[model samples]
Target: MTDTTEPTALLTAIDLTARDARVRKRHRAELRFRGYGIFSIGVAVAALLWLFTSLAVGGAGAVYTTYIKIDVHLDQTVIDPDATGDAAVFAKASYQSLIRSGLRNHFPGVTGRRDQRALNGLVTLAAPYLLRDIVLDDPALIGTKTGIWILASDEADLIARGKGTKRSTKSRNDGQAAWIAELRSQDRVERRFNWQFFTGGDSREPELAGILVAMIGSVLSLLVCFAVAFPVGVLAAVYLQEFARRTWITTLFEVNINNLAAVPSIIFGLLGLYIFLNVLHLPRSAPLVGGLVLALMTLPTIIIASRAALQSVPESIRDGALAVGASRVQAIFHHVVPIALPGMMTGTILGMARALGETAPLLMIGMVAFIVDVPKSILDPATALPVQIFLWADSPERAFVDKTSAAILVLLGFMVLMNAGAVLIRNRFEVRL
Candidate 1:
């Protein structure tokens, strides 16, 4: 009996050792998996940091603009040849000649027509229009010589900012480098915060270009998109989750909605082109059409997210409300819906943010037109921020590189703001069960 008992104890000890070994193996595997997860997260964070840093560095130059201070004799002969004293006369005047004359007077050594042409290239082509507007606003400045700061041409701007390596040689040969240096010595060349970058509209001249028009267009489109998508998406979600009976028809709709959420955004653009543009004859390149296209693209996302949010509410909440004498509709809308509204709004904001950054859909609907005037309404022909960024990125002008990067930063800023709003909404109003 003693020998049998000892053999049994030894077998038990061996089994215990085997079980401990297995447990240790599992712990090792878990540690490895945790390490892998941490590594992946670190990689993702680092990549995002790199991307932001690069964009900020590249776009830094666009925040400031170079200006050349010059004393221009607002020659009445050139500005008001008819002496009609009408603003129309000021508008039609060749202020370019005045600018050229001022430059020639400032540098007496630049005599030849070829050299004079090169000298004129130092200032922005919009300088004449700027002077014309100034005179029209203040007619008193028509005959006086005043010191004015005018936007330097893109090339001169780059050189002043120490970013003109590619054009440095050409500028030196054309005597433009010498003139810039002279202006710098006389305190006539300065770099200042570019208010025009925020206030003006698109321009062939980079210094005169701004994002205001595009920003307005984006806001108008988003307004239209939200107006159309939010109600439709929420109502559809409510009907599907609360009122619709469980059947093959409902199942088919669920499947189709899930599938639509995954469809390419450009397909929706094409659909908008066919239905809104060709069939309905809506204005081309209008923010109204762009918004409608974006609404179609964003609807599926909003519906899917809203449905998920609704499903997250516990069934007990609905049953309790109904047991207390509340009707089915009241139980769902009053208690269940309020609890889910935060999630629904969060989803809608995220969807709108995604739509804001979409260029392809807007492009398909002809929002890619070069719209110079700021739109006053959704029906006006306009270009969105993303579309503007795409257009700038494709430009061949060297200065546009900085403008493109700056525009991207603005786009990213809006996206971040939208996402932050979503997070704040969720945290502030989220219902805990």
Candidate 2:
């Protein structure tokens, strides 16, 4: 063997040099990882921005429509003399036939059945109903003419409202410009504001379809969701975090809540259908039933989030309340809950946003397929906005494509407003401690 001192010195120097090299390598690697992380975040932000811009550009044209003022003349020639003896004389075929003939007179330049129907399609369904009412109410106007500028279809409204060919540009992506040109030749396609989107029902015609029914459905269902989910989820979370004793029993439930949060929403929907519709026999396809299903799916989310919020409250605050002679319940209710509310609201709002966009479970609950008048109550058959969009998106009609995007825009607006309100409430009421 070599001299002991020489071997020891050589080994020690080599070990020191190798250790220094490893330390330097690790430091360089850490910097590279950090740089890559920042770069990935930046790319993700840019991609999201691009996506939002595209959707906004495509969706903004869905809310307004075009219109033309026509001076419609009413006279004895249009209203039958003998029909006046009937209580529902206004519903006579003579009056309808004459009025149809007169409208045909106005667009004399159009002759083909397709062309005339296309122009007539520009006229909204509500327009003729409103006109009929006006004539029936004022019998004195029977010999006179009145001016009317009724709202038109969304495509025509865009043009009449000066939205200028957004669909025309969009169609360029699919080589549909030729068909759009044919529609233009037939005088059926134009950029127009879609007022009906806010006032109409789930029409087979996109121009007649609106968000009103879906809005009502969303409002009623969300009411049900909040009424049922908020109290239950909060209480469950409070019990888990504050009052439950340490045991395998409590631990099992704690794990179960987390697992529930990850379960698929549609599965909850099926459970709701079986329990609420099949067994309980609640009203089928009602907003109440849909809300109940959504509530079940959302409960785990709200409970998990609320529990995190409660955990975030400092232990010192709880101790202080107890030291001041407050009971456990009082301390938790007055101090801990108040402090945790902002975070709780934030979490609950996010979960609600998720719930609002859900359509599958709603589909199972009968919100998937419908084309009826708005319901008078929660028990009425109704469709939520996402489900409405889903139905239209599946339609073969070309116009339904834009209508789907428009409904999505409205749904998106509601979600943004809800989240914004949560932010405002947090800023206004949340305590720093």
TM-score to true structure, per model:
0.90, 0.78
lDDT of 1 at 99: 88
Regions of candidate 1 where Cα sits further than 4 Å from its true position: 1-35, 80-89, 137-142, 165-174
Model 2 stretches astray by more than 4 angstroms: 1-42, 68-75, 83-88, 91-96, 106-127, 137-140, 145-147, 150-193
- Clash count for candidate 2 is 18
Let me know the TM-score candidate 1 reaches against the reference structure. Answer: 0.90
lDDT per residue for candidate 2 within 150-256, as digits (tens), equals 55544455444334443444433222223334444656444455566777778765567777888889888988998899889998988899999989999999899
- What overall lDDT goes with each candidate model? 0.89, 0.75
lDDT of 1 by residue, 18-130 (tens): 98999999999999999999999999999999998888986877888899998899988888877889988789988898888888888989887777877898899999988
Q: At residue 1, what lDDT does model 1 achieve?
A: 94
RMSD of 1: 3.1
Model 2 scores a C-alpha lDDT of 0.75
Question: Cα deviation of 344 in candidate 2 (Å)?
Answer: 1.8
